[model samples]
Target: MTQGLKIVIVEDDALIAMDLADLLIGMGHDVCAIASTESEAIVTARRCKPDLMIVDGGLQEGNGIDAMRRIATEGFIPHLFVTGDPQRLAQGAPDAVIVGKPFTMRELSRGIAAALASGVPASAD
Candidate 1:
Protein backbone atom coordinates (compact mmCIF):
# COMPACT_ATOMS: atom_id res chain seq x y z
CA MET A 1 0.00 0.00 0.00
CA THR A 2 1.16 3.52 -0.77
CA GLN A 3 2.01 5.78 2.09
CA GLY A 4 0.09 8.96 2.70
CA LEU A 5 1.62 11.93 0.91
CA LYS A 6 3.19 14.88 2.71
CA ILE A 7 2.07 18.12 1.08
CA VAL A 8 2.90 21.83 1.07
CA ILE A 9 0.59 24.56 -0.21
CA VAL A 10 1.84 27.81 -1.75
CA GLU A 11 -1.20 29.92 -2.39
CA ASP A 12 -1.68 33.64 -1.84
CA ASP A 13 -5.42 33.35 -1.49
CA ALA A 14 -6.27 32.47 2.09
CA LEU A 15 -9.60 30.82 1.37
CA ILE A 16 -8.29 28.72 -1.49
CA ALA A 17 -5.27 27.63 0.49
CA MET A 18 -7.33 26.65 3.49
CA ASP A 19 -9.83 24.80 1.33
CA LEU A 20 -7.14 22.87 -0.45
CA ALA A 21 -5.43 22.06 2.85
CA ASP A 22 -8.67 20.82 4.32
CA LEU A 23 -9.40 18.69 1.29
CA LEU A 24 -5.95 17.15 1.23
CA ILE A 25 -6.01 16.45 4.92
CA GLY A 26 -9.43 14.87 4.57
CA MET A 27 -7.98 12.66 1.86
CA GLY A 28 -5.43 11.39 4.40
CA HIS A 29 -2.42 13.42 3.41
CA ASP A 30 -0.27 15.44 5.78
CA VAL A 31 -0.08 19.14 5.01
CA CYS A 32 3.38 20.30 6.06
CA ALA A 33 3.03 24.00 5.42
CA ILE A 34 1.06 26.78 3.71
CA ALA A 35 2.83 29.80 2.24
CA SER A 36 1.55 32.98 0.63
CA THR A 37 4.75 34.32 -0.89
CA GLU A 38 7.44 32.87 -3.11
CA SER A 39 10.21 33.20 -0.54
CA GLU A 40 8.09 31.72 2.18
CA ALA A 41 7.05 28.89 -0.08
CA ILE A 42 10.59 28.06 -0.95
CA VAL A 43 11.69 28.21 2.67
CA THR A 44 8.79 26.13 3.84
CA ALA A 45 9.26 23.54 1.15
CA ARG A 46 12.92 23.21 2.01
CA ARG A 47 12.28 22.93 5.69
CA CYS A 48 9.26 20.65 5.45
CA LYS A 49 10.69 18.38 2.76
CA PRO A 50 7.23 17.28 1.70
CA ASP A 51 6.49 14.67 -0.93
CA LEU A 52 4.20 16.95 -2.89
CA MET A 53 3.68 20.68 -3.36
CA ILE A 54 0.66 22.59 -4.70
CA VAL A 55 1.61 26.09 -5.76
CA ASP A 56 -0.38 28.99 -7.12
CA GLY A 57 0.71 30.90 -10.20
CA GLY A 58 0.72 34.30 -8.60
CA LEU A 59 2.12 35.27 -5.21
CA GLN A 60 2.48 38.50 -3.29
CA GLU A 61 6.28 38.57 -3.40
CA GLY A 62 6.99 36.64 -6.59
CA ASN A 63 5.57 34.21 -9.11
CA GLY A 64 5.07 30.58 -8.17
CA ILE A 65 7.05 29.47 -11.21
CA ASP A 66 10.13 31.10 -9.79
CA ALA A 67 9.60 29.38 -6.48
CA MET A 68 9.16 26.07 -8.27
CA ARG A 69 12.38 26.65 -10.16
CA ARG A 70 14.20 27.41 -6.95
CA ILE A 71 12.85 24.35 -5.26
CA ALA A 72 13.81 22.23 -8.23
CA THR A 73 17.30 23.62 -8.25
CA GLU A 74 17.65 22.78 -4.62
CA GLY A 75 16.81 19.15 -5.35
CA PHE A 76 13.62 19.16 -3.34
CA ILE A 77 9.91 18.34 -3.52
CA PRO A 78 7.79 17.37 -6.52
CA HIS A 79 5.38 20.18 -7.24
CA LEU A 80 2.22 21.02 -9.18
CA PHE A 81 0.91 24.39 -10.26
CA VAL A 82 -2.69 25.22 -9.39
CA THR A 83 -3.89 28.26 -11.24
CA GLY A 84 -6.85 29.79 -13.04
CA ASP A 85 -4.63 30.82 -15.94
CA PRO A 86 -3.22 28.04 -18.07
CA GLN A 87 -1.36 30.63 -20.08
CA ARG A 88 0.71 31.53 -17.06
CA LEU A 89 1.59 27.90 -16.57
CA ALA A 90 2.81 27.65 -20.13
CA GLN A 91 5.78 29.70 -19.06
CA GLY A 92 6.41 27.54 -16.01
CA ALA A 93 9.28 25.14 -15.43
CA PRO A 94 9.47 22.28 -17.88
CA ASP A 95 7.52 19.14 -17.06
CA ALA A 96 5.69 20.94 -14.26
CA VAL A 97 2.18 19.61 -13.65
CA ILE A 98 -0.55 22.22 -13.89
CA VAL A 99 -3.84 21.64 -12.11
CA GLY A 100 -6.33 24.36 -12.96
CA LYS A 101 -7.97 26.33 -10.18
CA PRO A 102 -11.58 25.61 -9.12
CA PHE A 103 -10.72 21.96 -9.20
CA THR A 104 -12.88 19.52 -7.34
CA MET A 105 -11.45 17.33 -4.62
CA ARG A 106 -11.68 14.38 -6.98
CA GLU A 107 -9.76 16.23 -9.65
CA LEU A 108 -7.10 17.37 -7.24
CA SER A 109 -6.81 13.89 -5.84
CA ARG A 110 -6.38 12.43 -9.29
CA GLY A 111 -3.77 14.94 -10.25
CA ILE A 112 -1.77 14.29 -7.09
CA ALA A 113 -1.99 10.56 -7.61
CA ALA A 114 -0.79 10.83 -11.20
CA ALA A 115 2.11 13.02 -10.23
CA LEU A 116 3.14 10.57 -7.56
CA ALA A 117 2.80 7.62 -9.92
CA SER A 118 4.93 9.22 -12.61
CA GLY A 119 7.92 9.34 -10.23
CA VAL A 120 9.38 12.30 -12.01
CA PRO A 121 12.58 13.69 -10.55
CA ALA A 122 12.46 17.00 -8.79
CA SER A 123 13.72 19.87 -10.95
CA ALA A 124 17.53 19.90 -11.12
CA ASP A 125 17.90 23.39 -12.51
Candidate 2:
Protein backbone atom coordinates (compact mmCIF):
# COMPACT_ATOMS: atom_id res chain seq x y z
CA MET A 1 0.00 0.00 0.00
CA THR A 2 2.68 2.46 1.00
CA GLN A 3 5.81 1.30 -0.80
CA GLY A 4 6.43 -2.43 -0.77
CA LEU A 5 9.71 -3.85 0.39
CA LYS A 6 11.86 -6.24 -1.58
CA ILE A 7 11.87 -9.29 0.66
CA VAL A 8 13.43 -12.71 1.01
CA ILE A 9 11.93 -15.61 2.99
CA VAL A 10 14.18 -18.27 4.53
CA GLU A 11 11.91 -21.16 5.48
CA ASP A 12 12.31 -24.92 5.28
CA ASP A 13 8.73 -26.12 4.91
CA ALA A 14 7.67 -25.86 1.32
CA LEU A 15 4.00 -25.19 2.07
CA ILE A 16 4.92 -22.68 4.71
CA ALA A 17 7.34 -20.98 2.34
CA MET A 18 4.65 -20.68 -0.32
CA ASP A 19 2.20 -19.30 2.22
CA LEU A 20 4.70 -16.70 3.31
CA ALA A 21 5.41 -15.71 -0.24
CA ASP A 22 1.72 -15.30 -0.90
CA LEU A 23 1.29 -13.19 2.18
CA LEU A 24 4.15 -10.94 1.09
CA ILE A 25 2.60 -10.54 -2.30
CA GLY A 26 -0.79 -9.76 -0.79
CA MET A 27 0.90 -7.05 1.22
CA GLY A 28 2.38 -5.68 -2.02
CA HIS A 29 5.98 -6.70 -1.34
CA ASP A 30 8.16 -8.32 -3.93
CA VAL A 31 9.63 -11.66 -2.89
CA CYS A 32 13.13 -11.74 -4.25
CA ALA A 33 13.85 -15.27 -3.14
CA ILE A 34 12.67 -18.11 -0.94
CA ALA A 35 15.31 -20.36 0.58
CA SER A 36 15.02 -23.50 2.64
CA THR A 37 18.57 -23.91 3.87
CA GLU A 38 21.28 -21.79 5.40
CA SER A 39 23.54 -21.96 2.38
CA GLU A 40 20.72 -21.18 0.02
CA ALA A 41 19.51 -18.36 2.21
CA ILE A 42 22.94 -16.76 2.23
CA VAL A 43 23.47 -17.18 -1.48
CA THR A 44 20.03 -15.84 -2.33
CA ALA A 45 20.30 -12.94 0.07
CA ARG A 46 23.53 -11.83 -1.52
CA ARG A 47 22.11 -12.19 -4.99
CA CYS A 48 18.80 -10.52 -4.20
CA LYS A 49 19.88 -7.75 -1.86
CA PRO A 50 16.44 -7.66 -0.33
CA ASP A 51 15.21 -4.80 1.81
CA LEU A 52 14.07 -7.26 4.48
CA MET A 53 14.26 -10.96 5.24
CA ILE A 54 11.61 -13.00 7.03
CA VAL A 55 13.43 -16.01 8.38
CA ASP A 56 12.39 -19.14 10.17
CA GLY A 57 14.27 -19.64 13.40
CA GLY A 58 14.99 -23.25 12.57
CA LEU A 59 15.91 -24.91 9.32
CA GLN A 60 17.23 -28.32 8.27
CA GLU A 61 20.71 -26.94 7.79
CA GLY A 62 22.20 -24.36 10.18
CA ASN A 63 19.03 -22.43 11.09
CA GLY A 64 18.20 -18.75 10.75
CA ILE A 65 20.50 -17.68 13.56
CA ASP A 66 23.40 -19.25 11.74
CA ALA A 67 22.36 -17.60 8.48
CA MET A 68 21.90 -14.20 10.15
CA ARG A 69 25.26 -14.50 11.87
CA ARG A 70 26.82 -14.55 8.45
CA ILE A 71 24.48 -12.00 6.84
CA ALA A 72 25.15 -9.54 9.64
CA THR A 73 28.83 -9.42 8.83
CA GLU A 74 28.16 -8.10 5.34
CA GLY A 75 26.25 -5.16 6.83
CA PHE A 76 22.69 -4.54 7.94
CA ILE A 77 19.52 -5.89 6.40
CA PRO A 78 16.39 -5.71 8.52
CA HIS A 79 15.08 -9.13 9.51
CA LEU A 80 12.17 -10.71 11.36
CA PHE A 81 12.18 -14.10 13.05
CA VAL A 82 9.02 -16.08 12.39
CA THR A 83 9.22 -19.28 14.36
CA GLY A 84 7.39 -21.42 16.89
CA ASP A 85 9.88 -20.93 19.66
CA PRO A 86 10.33 -17.26 20.35
CA GLN A 87 12.62 -17.89 23.32
CA ARG A 88 15.14 -19.80 21.27
CA LEU A 89 15.32 -17.10 18.62
CA ALA A 90 15.50 -14.34 21.22
CA GLN A 91 18.57 -15.92 22.75
CA GLY A 92 20.26 -16.11 19.38
CA ALA A 93 19.01 -12.86 17.90
CA PRO A 94 18.29 -10.40 20.65
CA ASP A 95 17.83 -7.45 18.37
CA ALA A 96 15.28 -9.03 16.08
CA VAL A 97 11.54 -8.68 16.55
CA ILE A 98 10.33 -12.28 16.59
CA VAL A 99 6.90 -13.46 15.50
CA GLY A 100 5.93 -16.97 16.48
CA LYS A 101 4.79 -19.32 13.71
CA PRO A 102 1.10 -20.10 13.00
CA PHE A 103 0.63 -16.36 13.16
CA THR A 104 -2.11 -14.47 11.40
CA MET A 105 -1.26 -12.46 8.29
CA ARG A 106 -2.22 -9.34 10.20
CA GLU A 107 0.14 -10.25 13.01
CA LEU A 108 2.93 -11.04 10.59
CA SER A 109 2.25 -7.74 8.87
CA ARG A 110 2.60 -5.94 12.18
CA GLY A 111 5.90 -7.64 12.85
CA ILE A 112 7.08 -6.66 9.38
CA ALA A 113 6.10 -3.08 9.99
CA ALA A 114 7.93 -3.03 13.29
CA ALA A 115 11.05 -4.58 11.84
CA LEU A 116 11.10 -2.18 8.92
CA ALA A 117 10.73 0.73 11.31
CA SER A 118 13.50 -0.68 13.47
CA GLY A 119 15.86 -0.68 10.51
CA VAL A 120 18.94 -2.82 10.09
CA PRO A 121 19.34 -6.14 11.78
CA ALA A 122 21.98 -5.79 14.48
CA SER A 123 25.38 -7.28 13.69
CA ALA A 124 25.88 -10.66 15.34
CA ASP A 125 29.33 -9.53 16.29
Candidate 3:
Protein backbone atom coordinates (compact mmCIF):
# COMPACT_ATOMS: atom_id res chain seq x y z
CA MET A 1 0.00 0.00 0.00
CA THR A 2 1.07 3.55 -0.60
CA GLN A 3 2.22 5.54 2.41
CA GLY A 4 0.09 8.43 3.56
CA LEU A 5 1.42 11.82 2.59
CA LYS A 6 3.00 14.07 5.23
CA ILE A 7 1.65 17.61 5.04
CA VAL A 8 2.36 21.01 6.58
CA ILE A 9 -0.16 23.87 6.76
CA VAL A 10 0.71 27.56 7.07
CA GLU A 11 -2.48 29.45 7.78
CA ASP A 12 -3.03 32.40 10.10
CA ASP A 13 -6.75 31.76 10.63
CA ALA A 14 -7.21 29.40 13.54
CA LEU A 15 -10.53 27.90 12.47
CA ILE A 16 -9.49 27.45 8.89
CA ALA A 17 -6.18 25.90 9.89
CA MET A 18 -7.85 23.43 12.21
CA ASP A 19 -10.50 22.58 9.65
CA LEU A 20 -7.91 21.96 6.98
CA ALA A 21 -5.84 19.83 9.36
CA ASP A 22 -8.91 17.83 10.34
CA LEU A 23 -9.83 17.24 6.73
CA LEU A 24 -6.34 16.10 5.81
CA ILE A 25 -6.12 13.82 8.84
CA GLY A 26 -9.57 12.42 8.06
CA MET A 27 -8.32 11.63 4.57
CA GLY A 28 -5.49 9.51 6.08
CA HIS A 29 -2.76 12.05 5.46
CA ASP A 30 -0.47 13.05 8.32
CA VAL A 31 -0.36 16.71 9.33
CA CYS A 32 3.19 17.24 10.44
CA ALA A 33 2.97 20.92 11.31
CA ILE A 34 0.67 23.96 11.34
CA ALA A 35 1.95 27.52 11.55
CA SER A 36 0.21 30.90 11.88
CA THR A 37 3.14 33.13 11.03
CA GLU A 38 5.67 33.17 8.23
CA SER A 39 8.64 32.71 10.55
CA GLU A 40 7.02 29.83 12.34
CA ALA A 41 6.01 28.25 9.07
CA ILE A 42 9.54 28.47 7.75
CA VAL A 43 10.94 26.92 10.90
CA THR A 44 8.34 24.15 10.94
CA ALA A 45 8.71 23.38 7.26
CA ARG A 46 12.46 23.05 7.56
CA ARG A 47 12.22 20.88 10.63
CA CYS A 48 9.35 18.67 9.50
CA LYS A 49 10.42 18.30 5.87
CA PRO A 50 6.90 17.40 4.89
CA ASP A 51 5.97 15.75 1.64
CA LEU A 52 3.53 18.51 0.85
CA MET A 53 2.81 22.02 2.10
CA ILE A 54 -0.41 24.06 1.82
CA VAL A 55 0.16 27.75 2.46
CA ASP A 56 -2.24 30.66 2.89
CA GLY A 57 -1.52 33.93 1.13
CA GLY A 58 -1.88 36.10 4.18
CA LEU A 59 0.34 35.53 7.18
CA GLN A 60 1.29 37.45 10.30
CA GLU A 61 5.01 37.85 9.77
CA GLY A 62 5.00 37.66 5.98
CA ASN A 63 3.08 36.34 3.00
CA GLY A 64 2.87 32.69 1.99
CA ILE A 65 4.57 33.46 -1.29
CA ASP A 66 7.65 34.44 0.64
CA ALA A 67 7.53 31.19 2.57
CA MET A 68 7.16 29.24 -0.65
CA ARG A 69 10.07 31.03 -2.16
CA ARG A 70 12.17 30.33 0.90
CA ILE A 71 11.29 26.65 0.77
CA ALA A 72 12.11 26.54 -2.90
CA THR A 73 15.42 28.29 -2.48
CA GLU A 74 16.41 26.10 0.42
CA GLY A 75 15.64 22.88 -1.33
CA PHE A 76 12.60 20.90 -2.55
CA ILE A 77 9.06 20.35 -1.36
CA PRO A 78 5.64 20.11 -2.96
CA HIS A 79 3.95 23.46 -2.32
CA LEU A 80 0.40 24.59 -3.04
CA PHE A 81 -1.21 27.96 -2.59
CA VAL A 82 -4.49 27.87 -0.70
CA THR A 83 -5.61 31.44 -0.70
CA GLY A 84 -8.53 33.82 -1.16
CA ASP A 85 -6.73 36.17 -3.52
CA PRO A 86 -6.27 34.48 -6.86
CA GLN A 87 -5.20 37.63 -8.70
CA ARG A 88 -2.27 38.28 -6.41
CA LEU A 89 -1.38 34.61 -6.50
CA ALA A 90 -1.48 34.63 -10.27
CA GLN A 91 0.90 37.54 -10.42
CA GLY A 92 3.22 36.45 -7.62
CA ALA A 93 3.06 32.69 -7.72
CA PRO A 94 2.18 31.77 -11.25
CA ASP A 95 3.72 28.30 -11.09
CA ALA A 96 2.13 27.19 -7.84
CA VAL A 97 -0.79 24.79 -7.68
CA ILE A 98 -3.71 26.70 -6.20
CA VAL A 99 -6.63 25.53 -4.11
CA GLY A 100 -8.83 28.49 -3.34
CA LYS A 101 -10.13 29.12 0.14
CA PRO A 102 -13.43 27.38 1.06
CA PHE A 103 -12.27 24.42 -0.97
CA THR A 104 -13.97 21.07 -0.55
CA MET A 105 -12.22 18.09 0.99
CA ARG A 106 -12.46 16.38 -2.36
CA GLU A 107 -10.68 19.26 -4.00
CA LEU A 108 -7.98 19.31 -1.36
CA SER A 109 -7.56 15.57 -1.62
CA ARG A 110 -7.22 15.73 -5.36
CA GLY A 111 -4.70 18.51 -5.16
CA ILE A 112 -2.62 16.60 -2.62
CA ALA A 113 -2.71 13.41 -4.64
CA ALA A 114 -1.86 15.24 -7.81
CA ALA A 115 1.03 16.99 -6.16
CA LEU A 116 2.36 13.73 -4.80
CA ALA A 117 1.93 11.87 -8.07
CA SER A 118 3.78 14.60 -9.92
CA GLY A 119 6.65 14.12 -7.43
CA VAL A 120 7.55 16.24 -4.42
CA PRO A 121 10.31 18.41 -5.86
CA ALA A 122 8.63 18.68 -9.24
CA SER A 123 6.19 21.35 -8.08
CA ALA A 124 8.94 23.51 -6.60
CA ASP A 125 10.10 24.50 -10.02
Candidate 4:
Protein backbone atom coordinates (compact mmCIF):
# COMPACT_ATOMS: atom_id res chain seq x y z
CA MET A 1 0.00 0.00 0.00
CA THR A 2 2.96 2.29 -0.72
CA GLN A 3 4.36 2.48 2.79
CA GLY A 4 1.48 4.58 4.04
CA LEU A 5 1.49 6.12 7.50
CA LYS A 6 2.34 3.60 10.21
CA ILE A 7 -0.41 3.87 12.79
CA VAL A 8 -1.08 2.60 16.27
CA ILE A 9 -4.65 2.04 17.41
CA VAL A 10 -5.50 2.37 21.08
CA GLU A 11 -8.96 1.18 21.97
CA ASP A 12 -10.32 -0.85 24.86
CA ASP A 13 -12.88 -2.81 22.90
CA ALA A 14 -11.56 -5.69 20.88
CA LEU A 15 -14.33 -5.51 18.34
CA ILE A 16 -13.76 -1.81 17.90
CA ALA A 17 -10.06 -2.32 17.50
CA MET A 18 -10.66 -4.96 14.84
CA ASP A 19 -12.98 -2.68 12.97
CA LEU A 20 -10.46 0.15 13.16
CA ALA A 21 -7.72 -2.13 11.91
CA ASP A 22 -9.82 -3.08 8.91
CA LEU A 23 -10.62 0.54 8.20
CA LEU A 24 -6.99 1.63 8.37
CA ILE A 25 -5.88 -1.21 6.15
CA GLY A 26 -8.56 -0.45 3.64
CA MET A 27 -7.36 3.13 3.61
CA GLY A 28 -3.85 1.83 2.79
CA HIS A 29 -2.35 2.71 6.13
CA ASP A 30 -0.32 0.25 8.18
CA VAL A 31 -1.40 -0.66 11.68
CA CYS A 32 1.81 -1.24 13.57
CA ALA A 33 0.09 -2.25 16.77
CA ILE A 34 -3.21 -2.39 18.62
CA ALA A 35 -3.43 -1.67 22.31
CA SER A 36 -6.35 -2.03 24.67
CA THR A 37 -5.08 -0.21 27.72
CA GLU A 38 -3.17 2.96 28.46
CA SER A 39 -0.11 1.08 29.58
CA GLU A 40 -0.09 -1.12 26.51
CA ALA A 41 -0.51 1.87 24.22
CA ILE A 42 2.36 3.75 25.80
CA VAL A 43 4.61 0.73 25.63
CA THR A 44 3.77 -0.04 22.03
CA ALA A 45 4.18 3.58 20.99
CA ARG A 46 7.57 3.78 22.63
CA ARG A 47 8.72 0.65 20.87
CA CYS A 48 7.24 1.29 17.45
CA LYS A 49 7.55 5.03 16.91
CA PRO A 50 4.52 5.01 14.67
CA ASP A 51 3.75 8.04 12.55
CA LEU A 52 0.51 8.61 14.40
CA MET A 53 -1.83 7.10 16.92
CA ILE A 54 -5.61 6.77 16.91
CA VAL A 55 -6.62 6.76 20.54
CA ASP A 56 -9.87 6.31 22.37
CA GLY A 57 -10.92 9.17 24.68
CA GLY A 58 -11.47 6.86 27.62
CA LEU A 59 -9.34 3.75 27.87
CA GLN A 60 -9.40 0.56 29.88
CA GLU A 61 -6.74 1.03 32.53
CA GLY A 62 -5.95 4.72 32.33
CA ASN A 63 -6.89 7.46 29.87
CA GLY A 64 -5.88 8.28 26.31
CA ILE A 65 -4.53 11.76 27.07
CA ASP A 66 -2.15 10.48 29.70
CA ALA A 67 -0.97 7.68 27.47
CA MET A 68 -0.51 10.01 24.53
CA ARG A 69 1.40 12.48 26.67
CA ARG A 70 3.90 9.83 27.65
CA ILE A 71 4.21 8.56 24.09
CA ALA A 72 4.79 12.06 22.69
CA THR A 73 7.87 12.52 24.83
CA GLU A 74 9.95 10.64 22.29
CA GLY A 75 8.90 13.02 19.54
CA PHE A 76 5.89 14.66 18.00
CA ILE A 77 3.57 11.74 17.44
CA PRO A 78 0.35 13.15 16.12
CA HIS A 79 -2.93 11.72 17.38
CA LEU A 80 -6.62 11.54 16.50
CA PHE A 81 -9.01 10.99 19.36
CA VAL A 82 -12.17 9.03 18.59
CA THR A 83 -14.70 9.08 21.36
CA GLY A 84 -18.35 9.47 22.14
CA ASP A 85 -17.38 12.13 24.65
CA PRO A 86 -15.27 14.71 22.87
CA GLN A 87 -15.70 17.59 25.28
CA ARG A 88 -13.55 16.04 28.00
CA LEU A 89 -10.61 15.51 25.71
CA ALA A 90 -10.94 18.96 24.15
CA GLN A 91 -10.17 20.56 27.49
CA GLY A 92 -7.07 18.42 28.00
CA ALA A 93 -5.97 18.71 24.40
CA PRO A 94 -7.50 21.80 22.96
CA ASP A 95 -5.93 21.62 19.52
CA ALA A 96 -5.93 17.89 19.11
CA VAL A 97 -7.93 16.53 16.23
CA ILE A 98 -10.95 14.51 17.29
CA VAL A 99 -13.86 12.63 15.79
CA GLY A 100 -16.93 11.60 17.71
CA LYS A 101 -17.72 7.92 17.96
CA PRO A 102 -19.88 6.46 15.19
CA PHE A 103 -17.63 8.53 12.94
CA THR A 104 -18.12 8.09 9.27
CA MET A 105 -15.11 7.04 7.23
CA ARG A 106 -14.87 10.57 5.87
CA GLU A 107 -14.66 12.14 9.29
CA LEU A 108 -11.94 9.75 10.42
CA SER A 109 -9.96 10.38 7.25
CA ARG A 110 -10.16 14.12 7.70
CA GLY A 111 -9.04 13.91 11.29
CA ILE A 112 -6.07 11.76 10.30
CA ALA A 113 -5.01 14.16 7.62
CA ALA A 114 -5.34 17.15 9.92
CA ALA A 115 -3.34 15.54 12.71
CA LEU A 116 -0.55 14.45 10.35
CA ALA A 117 -0.38 17.77 8.52
CA SER A 118 0.39 19.60 11.77
CA GLY A 119 2.85 17.01 13.14
CA VAL A 120 0.95 17.66 16.34
CA PRO A 121 -2.80 17.23 16.46
CA ALA A 122 -4.57 20.22 14.99
CA SER A 123 -8.14 21.42 15.19
CA ALA A 124 -10.29 19.40 12.82
CA ASP A 125 -13.37 21.04 11.29
Task: Return the top candidate by TM-score.
Answer: 2
* Residue lDDT tens for model 1, 11-125: 9999999999998888888998999999998899879998988889888889888887777777746677888986657565556677887888777877787666665643434
lDDT of 3 at 118: 53
Off by over 4 Å in 2: 120-125
TM-score of 4: 0.90
lDDT of 3 by residue, 78-97 (tens): 87778887677767766667
- Clashing residue pairs in candidate 1, if any? none
Superior by lDDT: candidate 2 or candidate 3: 2
Superposed model 3: Cα runs more than 4 Å off: 1-3, 117-125
Could you give candidate 4's per-residue lDDT for residues 3-121 as a string of tens digits? 39999999999999999999999999999999999999989988888988999989869988888777766566888899988887898888788899999988998888887776763
lDDT winner between candidates 3 and 4:
4
**TM-scores, each model vs. reference:** 0.87, 0.92, 0.87, 0.90
For candidate 1, the clash count comes to 0
Error of 2 at 58 (Å): 0.4
lDDT of each: 0.80, 0.86, 0.79, 0.85
